[model samples]
Target chain A: MALVEIKNVRKSFGALEVLKDVSLTVEEGEIVTIIGRSGSGKSTLLRCINGLEDIQDGEIRVEGQQVHGQMKKLRELRQKVGIVFQAFNLFPHLTVERNITLAPIRTGRVSKADARALAEKVLAQVGLSEKIDAYPEQLSGGQQQRVAIARCLAMSPDLMLFDEVTSALDPELVGEVLKVMEDMASRGMTMILVTHEMAFARDVATKIVFMHQGRVWEEGPPSELFSSPKTPELKSFIGSNH
Target chain B: MQNLNFQQVLRYQDEFLHGIVNTLEMTAIAAFFGLLIGVVGAVLVGSGPKPVRILVKAYIELIRNTPPLIQLFVIFFIFPSAGIRLAPFPAACVALSIYFGAYAIEIIRSGLASIPKSQVEAGECLGLTRFEVFRYVVLAPALRNIYPSITSQLILLLLGTSVASQIAAEELFHTATFVESRTFRSFEVYALISAIYVALVVASRVIFAIVGAVAFRWPVRR
Candidate 1:
């Protein structure tokens, strides 16, 4: 079984359906990039997997544990599925180290000392060790996103969800965030990304899923999907990007 | 013109001291109950189901629209027929609490509403339970954002205690009334008590400022 399985999921906001019969599987240590135009439900799908948005129908299982409807179990699943949002969402009141260590201390019941050590280790991994005491507002957009990544990594989640993580950054800052994500990819971390960075998606994605009009329009290895998309929607989407 | 007895008025200073103590005690009780009702009502109105929220809204509107003096009279006079008999001090506290609570609820509810949804979602995604999120994320930030409003409401409640005099609660204003009547020194007695009330308001503000700096240190500078 895959590490993360989203089976036959359907979601709607009032009358408009955002995801229709969406099914996908994320294998361990694989990098899956979901690409589409705006309002294509890529972010919504990521939110459902992370239990941020509840699906109207079907199940999302993180490591075989159902995430929807079971509120108590959802917290446990969320601890194992770290999600980085487009907006960094760092706790502005806390320092970067405290932001990273808060979940481990509160949820995992790790001692403050141990949590700080783990936070430092992950900060170092993201090349943000020098910013342990800085507030989120003090950091650059790229630095803030890197700190957000470290925050998720400190929880030691089995799967990481990146929802347009770099889309909010400055044009010059995008490459630094992409570098950090690529480093995580090289280290064999299973990641699901909803992104518009075509080159990074082409280079780092093990699989690329193209979504259009609230459904999976096409999906395959990045080479096949990028080079010779089967569906007209996928072709046009790739065409618009280039 | 020399018929006025300033010595007797000076000798009854103990009664004035006792009145000050009584006023402080009443204000403390009223403030406590008012804060409780404010926070609970804010939560109910802010997050309750639609029907419950409507009920809370109606309750707040009813209290806010009616005068505190009239509400005090109703609680003291009318509630006795309903088998709810409270002594003057307790009745005053109850009435003032309900009166001030209405305004505080609106202030706190606005604070709760002003909190960005993203912060709550971030807390939820961090694996914090809903209750934990309310405690650590929601309430802290909500209270921080509304500190000025909360303090202002508290100070207003403290001033509102003057209305309890009508119920014969024997707080500061009631003391002034009694002392002025007994000594026939209306102007001096009232002026002294006004100064005391002003001092009390200033003192409470200083204390709250200190508490705000300590409790909400994350947001407020030292």
Candidate 2:
């Protein structure tokens, strides 16, 4: 069984269709990078997988259990699958330590006494142990994004989703966040990433999924997708990114 | 101008003291209820079902559109005719709370609106329950965002307590009227009460600033 399975997922926004019968599977420990233009439904598809957005049609299952829109079911699914957003939406009122430990402590996954240790462990993983006492605004953009990843990592999720995480970062700041992601990939974390960084996709992605017009335009190893483009869309996409 | 005889106004020191105490007590009671109603109404208006939203909206509009004096008159005067008889003080508190709550809902709702959707989504993604998301992620920041406006409304509510005197609540304004009726020192009495109002406003602002510093101590840019 696949770690994540999205089948025939059709989502629409009122009069506009965002995702059209999108189907994909993510096996365990596979870093699947989804690259697409804005409005191509890549982000929408990722949101659907975690039940953040309801689907008009189709099924998304993780670890053999179907994702449902029920509050309890969505909470359970989210506990297993964590997502890092583009804006690094850290809780502004909370210190970094509180931001990372709020869920784990509230959900009874960790006790109050142990929450500090748990927060320390995750912050260290993202090389932000020094910022445990700082607020989100105190950190640089890259640092805040790292803290966001740490916040997700603190959940001990089986799968992590990155939704254009680096797209909002300054050019110089993007590499640090990608470095943390690279570290996660090396440690065998299953990740589905929607990103514009083709180089990072080529380096870290086990398989690349190119999306166009709300469809997977191509799916192959990075070398195949880059070296031998089968479609004009993919060809132009790769060419333009260069 | 003739000499201001503050010495004669000061002859009614006990009356002035009682007035100050009553005014403070009424403001405190009304503030507590107003804060409660404002927060709950804001949440309901923002996320409650259509019917509930409409009901809360109606309440807010009704209170906001009408003058508090009229509302107080209805609660104090009309409610008695309908078999619900509240004394002068309780009636004033209720009227003031309802009045302050309406504007507070608008102020707090704007604060809640200022919180971006992405921030709430981040909390939901972490598996925080809906209430937990509001409490931990959204509440403090939203409150902080509108702290100044809410506090200003509170000061206005404090001043609005003067309206309660019309119902014979014997708060500051009513006490002043009684003093003036007896002493005929209208200028001195009015001047003294105005100074007290200024002092009260300034003192409350200081208190709010201290509370805000402690509650929202996170290193936000604002």
Candidate 3:
């Protein structure tokens, strides 16, 4: 079964349709990259998958389970599908360790000591073990994003969503986050990334999807999509990226 | 022809002290209820549904627009005619709570609104229920941001306790009036009571400052 599936998903804000009949499937352990123009519903699609943005029609399924408006079911789905935002979104009041441990302790009902241990392990994986006691504001943007990834990882999610994760980082800081993501991708994690970094998308994604006007314009293996395009829209979008 | 008698002033010292104690008690009760009403009203007005928000706004505007003295009269004197006769202390407390609560709602609403949207979204995305979000994220930061305004309002309410005396509550200013009339030492009596009121305000300010420092240690310098 596909790890993540969006079946005829449609979303609108007031009168404007943001995502129109979008459908896709992501298999387990595959890296899927979604590339699009600024208003192409890429972020909205990611938000819909994570249950952050409610959909007006259709359904999303994660790990073969339907994701919908029910709180308990959505929370259970969220425990398996971790999402990281462009803004990092670490809790400012909590230390790095506490930020990583919050959900594991709260939702998972893990003991404080065990949660701390898991937090330390993930923090070390992200190369932020030394800054365990630091607050979000004290860390550089790259370090904060690393902590955010570690935070998601601590929940033991089966699928991870990265919505322009490197977009907010300094140019010099982008490489470290991409490197962490690359490492996660290599470890057989199913990830759907909404990104503008064409080169990274080309290199890391098993399949690349191009979105246009709230619809999937074209999708294929990265080599074919990035190099030779059958559609003029995909060709023009790639041209504009350079 | 000296009209002042020193012995009479000393003879009424016990009653004078009782009035001071009564004033402090009334102020304490009023401050407690005022803070409670203020916080709950602020939270309701700041976060509730549209109808509740409108109701809260209307209540705040109504209370703030009317004078507190008139409010005391309505509560103490006018209500009695309608068979709602509350004793002086309770009536004074209810009046002050409603009055100060309206102003506090405005102050704290501003604080609650000042918190960034991203912060709230971050908490929500982390799977925290709305109540937990308010308790841990919204209220703590909102209270910290509005601490100065709230403290000032509280001290002002303490001074406003004198208005309760007009309703025959027998607080500090009422005692001063009685003392002045009995001893014929108007200047000395008024001056002493004014000094004591200043001392009480100063003491409450110091205590509040210490509490603010301890409670909000995470946000502010120690």
Candidate maximizing DockQ: 2
**Candidate 1 whole-model C-alpha lDDT, 0 to 1:** 0.88
Q: Rate the local accuracy (lDDT) of all candidates.
A: 0.88, 0.92, 0.86
Task: Estimate, for each residue in A87-163, the C-alpha lDDT of model 2 and write its tens digit.
Answer: 89999889999999999998889999999999999999999999999999999999999999999999999999999
Number of the top-ranking candidate, with TM-score as the measure: 2
What tens-digit string does per-residue lDDT give for candidate 3 at B94-179? Answer: 89888888888898788889777766765666666667667665777788889898889888988998998888888888898888
Q: Model 1, B51-74: lDDT tens per residue?
A: 989998998989988889999999
Ranking by lDDT: 2, 1, 3
Candidate 2 accuracy as TM-score: 0.97
Candidate 3 chain B lowest-lDDT run of ten:
B213-222
Write down the TM-score of every candidate: 0.93, 0.97, 0.89
What DockQ, on C-alphas, does every prediction get?
0.48, 0.76, 0.33
For model 2, residues B103-123, the per-residue Cα lDDT tens digits are 989999999999999888999
Give the docking tier of candidate 2: medium
Quality of model 2 by C-alpha lDDT: 0.92
